[model samples]
Every structure is written in C-alpha cells, then in structure tokens.
Target: MKEAIMIDLDGFYLEPVLVSIGAYGITPIYEKPEPPESEEADEAPELPEPILIGYRVAVPVPSGLFKPRYDLTTWKAALSAYDDAMDAYCAALAAYDPDSEDEPSQPPLQVDLRAFWIEGLTRQEIDNIRNAPSPKTDQQEIARLEQQSTISMLAITELFEMMLPIIMPEE
Candidate 1:
C-alpha cells in the first residue's frame, strides 16, 4: 500500500502545489500579485517582490535498524575507547622523532577526527596535538605511554567484540 504525504514549505521562491505519485516529483509554482495603487504621485515605486528563484532541501536517512540495539553504555564505551586509542597512538607518534628529517604521516584517526565531531579526549588534548606542541619526553617514557595505549587497545577490542554479531535471529 502507498500513502500520500503532505509537507508544508515556507520561505521559498516557488512552491510545490502537487507532487507526482511514486516518483514524488514536483515543479515550481509561483503566485503573481497585483500592482499596488498609488495615492500620491510622488509615491516611491513598490519594492519588487522577493523572487522565488532557488531553493534548497535537506533529507535525513536512518543509519540502520537492529534488534537488541546498542544502548547508552555501549555507545559511550565505543566512543571513549576510539578516542583513547587515537590519543595514545598520536602521542606515541609525536614522541618518536619530532626533529628528524623524515616526518611521520598523520594517522587516519587524527585526520578524520579533526574534520568530524566525536567523543573522548578533552578539547585541550585535541588542540595540543592539532597545534603541533613539542613532545615533553623521549622514548624513555614508554611505560607511562604504554599504559594508556594498552587501555585504549583493550577497549577497542571489547568494542569490536560487541560489534562482531550485533544481532541474532529470534529464538
């Protein structure tokens, strides 16, 4: 069965009066207004009506639907873990060799994170890395750095396990 859906639009140059079924196509329709009558000969010409020349539309699509969907805890953990891993990985790279003739390429995590919003790490931490701050210590600080890396790695592993088979057939 098919359903007819109606949407009201505002602030448009052309309005959609009717849309075709199935394909859902619409054409622009504009209303013409009568000229204003002038009482005084010195009256200024009526301002041109704002033309409906162009329009923009936004559509939202659901990512997916699943049984036993991810809850708050799962989402939070995955986000935190991803962020933590990114932080540790970037930190390790930064401490490797800052002044060396060969500069290391930035990881996909860091490059993508800067473009999009994600959880984990404070704004200061992200900024510190983004701004190219000097590495405070050398490779000797491996233990402390390794601890964070370990935690991030384990967290990511747990997240992957949760995603392995997200849903099962109803028993």
Candidate 2:
C-alpha cells in the first residue's frame, strides 16, 4: 500500500520597489500650435487619472530558489524547503515597468522596480547569475543599473553624481 504526500514552504520575502527616473532628459522642440479664437490661451489640459505607470521593470530571481531541493541535501531533512512561492512572486514582478512613455521626447518621472531582498544578497550577485530566460550580465552593468535606480527626492548627491557636462550657447 502507498500513502499520499504533500509539502509546504512558507517565508516572508522583500520585494524590490523601483523608484525610477529617465536616464537622459528628453526634450521636445515642438512649436506652439495656433490657439482657439474664443477659448482662454493658458488653460491647462484636464487630467482624469492622478497616477500612471511609466515603465515595466524585470525583477531578479531571489536566493530562496537559487538552489534546487535543499531539503534533500545531507544537511537537514525536516521537510523544510525554501520559499517556493518566490518563483511566481518573481514572475509577477517580471512586468515591473510596463508603462508607455507619455512624451517620448521629454524626460518623465518613471516608475521602476528595485527589489529589496529580505535576504542578504547584494544587487551585484543577483545580476550575475545566469537564468533560463536571460543571459548573464556583468557586475558593472549591474552597478550601472543600481545607479539608475537610486533616484531619491531626498538625496541631492544623486543629482551631482549624474554630472552631465554642459555646453555654453554659442555667442
């Protein structure tokens, strides 16, 4: 005779919250359109929704699923397993910044995802691991991304780090 088998793995994990901004400020050079004859000139466009999604960001796999079948290892066999739900969790996060650019020509405040892992894994290591879907990325690229995601309203240093050279207008 045979018996049934089931298992459960539970744990709390931190998700990345992308606080994003455009890399290069997009500038539009549109000429002012002709105004209506009777309507006011400076009336602003009426917006219906207060919030909008600017972009979709992909989330990195968590350390929980980093290895396969940890319980089967020689270490311990108390039926304890890594948080298996993280796969689905990460999948849901895959479409992080799924919003279209409002003005492709102008810089916009973008909503991006940055995972704050409950575990101690750093952004660099997570970026390097190769997965079935995407190829491996180097640490520098990961670092570059880290810099891009560090946009904070309270951090003035972030602006200075962007330090783009300015060209004086021709006399």
Candidate 3:
C-alpha cells in the first residue's frame, strides 16, 4: 500500500501518492498518524504536517490600501489646517451677499480642503479635487465643503485601518 505525504514548497503545498521518486534539491518527510475521525461529517479534515523543501523566503502580501506618506504628527497638522480653512471659508460665505450691486474689493479664495490633508490621496483623487467645478451658490458651496470634510474623515479612517497590521500583528 502507498501512503501520501504533503510537501511544502515556498508557501504552496503539494501531495504525492508515491514516495519512492526522489527529486534534486527537494526533501521529503514522513507524515504522522492521522487523527481519529469525528462523528460530525461536516467538520473539516485535519491536514498532515508538510515536508518543507528548499529555502522559504518571506514574501509580503499586498494590502491594496493607500499608504500615508506623512507621519501622524504631519497628518494632525494637516487636519488642523483643513479645519481652519473650512472655518474661514464658511465665515466668508455666511457674510457674502449675492444680491449686492457693488462687487466686493476682494473675493474669498476658493481653497480645496483636500489640499491640506492630502496624505493618502492618489493622483486621481488629487486631480478630482483640483478639477471639481466651483459651486454657483453659497449654499451649494457649503454643501460641497461638508462633503469634502466627510471624504477627509473616511481617508483618515482608511489610513488607520492600513496601519493596524503594523501596530498589532497576528501570532
């Protein structure tokens, strides 16, 4: 009777029916006795300990999440700047008179709050923020600013989530 033994090559596992065949640069280990089957058929089967072959190099998995370029302190400063910009913007808008016949000496600067907190913004995100149309009315502008604030908060949250693995890794 032939017995199968599991082999681990890098991170992949391979099981072979015959153990007589030998390959260069490979090591085969005999598996331990199988555990007794449980009464529950739905339970997962126990896998045998894999025989390791060749040197195993650690490969980092891609998170696919945005990595913040700035540290926490810089991000905090950016958030503060964003808040100040929003306040100044809202105040200016509140005092604006749409029906006024005389034009104001100086118009408020249309600053994008995202500019202040662009720690994790991609090129596309930055372009979208920069290319967004200016709101025709003060009310619309305020709404737009509020929406941007929400996006900023979500970005911050994503940044925190991305950092979690580094902060506390699994055992």
lDDT of each: 0.46, 0.35, 0.51
List clash counts for every candidate, in order. Answer: 1, 14, 0
* TM-score attained by model 2: 0.14
Candidate 2 per-residue lDDT over residues 8-87, each given as its tens digit: 12122223333234322111123344543546658765434333212122333344654322121221222122233444
lDDT of 3 by residue, 93-128 (tens): 788888987553444454332232223557798778
Poorest 10 consecutive residues of model 3 by lDDT? 54-63
Ranking according to lDDT, highest score first? 3, 1, 2
Kindly report which residue pairs in candidate 1 clash with one another: 13-52
Report how far off residue 101 is in candidate 3 (Å): 5.6
The positional error of residue 167 in candidate 1, measured at the CA in angstroms, is 72
Error of 3 at 110 (Å): 11
lDDT of 2 at 140: 70
Estimate the TM-score for candidate 3: 0.21
How does each model score on TM-score? 0.22, 0.14, 0.21
Best by lDDT: 3
Q: Compose the digit string of candidate 1's lDDT tens values, residues 98-166.
A: 678876756534222112212334567667667985666767478779989999999999998787677
